[model samples]
Target: ASNAYGNSVGRLVRLAVIILFIYAGLLGLTGLGFKIVPGGFLPTQDRGYAIVFAQLPDASSLDRTQAVVDKISKIAHETPGILNTVEFAGFNLFGG
Candidate 1:
């Protein structure tokens, strides 16, 4: 039976089956890759600095916000992994 298939036609059939198997494996791997990948389109990298935002109101005084921010900053400085704290008060971030 094996000797009967030892011919050009047999070789072609065997090659076709091998190619089909490779294609199937690649398709399965691609599906698996999709499942493992994260949803965001943006690639992630560590950002050393982080911005902390505080808001009071449209009528809130800059000085009041600054005082609050200063207290928060002092606390942040005492915390580990906090290299520094930059206060961003109000809408401008610079906060007038």
Candidate 2:
């Protein structure tokens, strides 16, 4: 009886792990199609996102920076996998 109980518990634990892995795999597969193609997952080497520090003397005026931001936003919007973007502008000194 003791051995049987231990065996059943072990089997249940293995089954639970297998079910969890299968669920995860299925959920992950749904996004597999989007992993490739333009605007999709970018490798670490990609310089696609550039963070500009506000303190730089050569930083463009707010309007010019906004123009650049808009351009990038448009590009992202037109891309297939990009869902949305949230941009925030804060006081240059305190925010960074």
Candidate 3:
């Protein structure tokens, strides 16, 4: 009789452990399952302004990069509200 009681108590303990794990899993699912943020901050197509691309001649060497820099600087000087200017050259063209 005592052995039967022990067996029944062990079964009940295992069932309780499984039930606790299932409940914890459900709580975690509820915490992480829903979407709060929308897809994008801005529209994909509605650009406020146009982007201008200027490519230098392929014969451009290290020295010729200065001419490209000068041209870009002149453009920056002519344009208003130029927040930033960046130049890419040589290996960085492939790197970036």
Candidate 4:
């Protein structure tokens, strides 16, 4: 087995030009892959969580905002297939 392995290594050494070409081709394919594939750590998916945003007219009172949030939370809790509701009154996520 050792003798056969030595002969194979000798043959490959003699084919250095072919080996270099194959290596270059593989590297080209890798660069092409980077261009073809989408770049993201994780693919976008529906994780079953939903965000509800509520907006009121300008100059609305904090109490009014809380009331609207509480009403939305209550309705969400009473609805079927909704596991839970989180209320964030007077907070505008997109406004920041």
Candidate 4 least-lDDT 10 residues = 39-48
lDDT of each: 0.80, 0.68, 0.69, 0.88
Model 4 spans with C-alpha error above 4 angstroms: 1-44
Task: Record all residue pairs in model 2 with backbone atoms less than 3 Å apart, i.e. clashing.
Answer: none
Q: Give the TM-score of each candidate.
A: 0.45, 0.34, 0.35, 0.51
Q: Report lDDT (Cα) of residue 79, candidate 3.
A: 83
- Cα lDDT tens digits, model 4, 1-96, are 999999999898879978899999999999999998877655566466879988899989999999999999999899898998778988989875
Residue 24, model 1, lDDT = 100
What C-alpha lDDT, on a 0 to 100 scale, does residue 82 get in candidate 4? 92
Question: Rank by lDDT, descending?
Answer: 4, 1, 3, 2
Q: List candidate 3 stretches off by more than 4 Å.
A: 34-96
Off by over 4 Å in 2: 1-59, 89-96
lDDT assessment of candidate 3 = 0.69
**Residue-wise lDDT of candidate 2 within 5-93, one digit each (tens)?**
99999999999999999999988886785575455467667865644433433555777666666776777789886677656443353
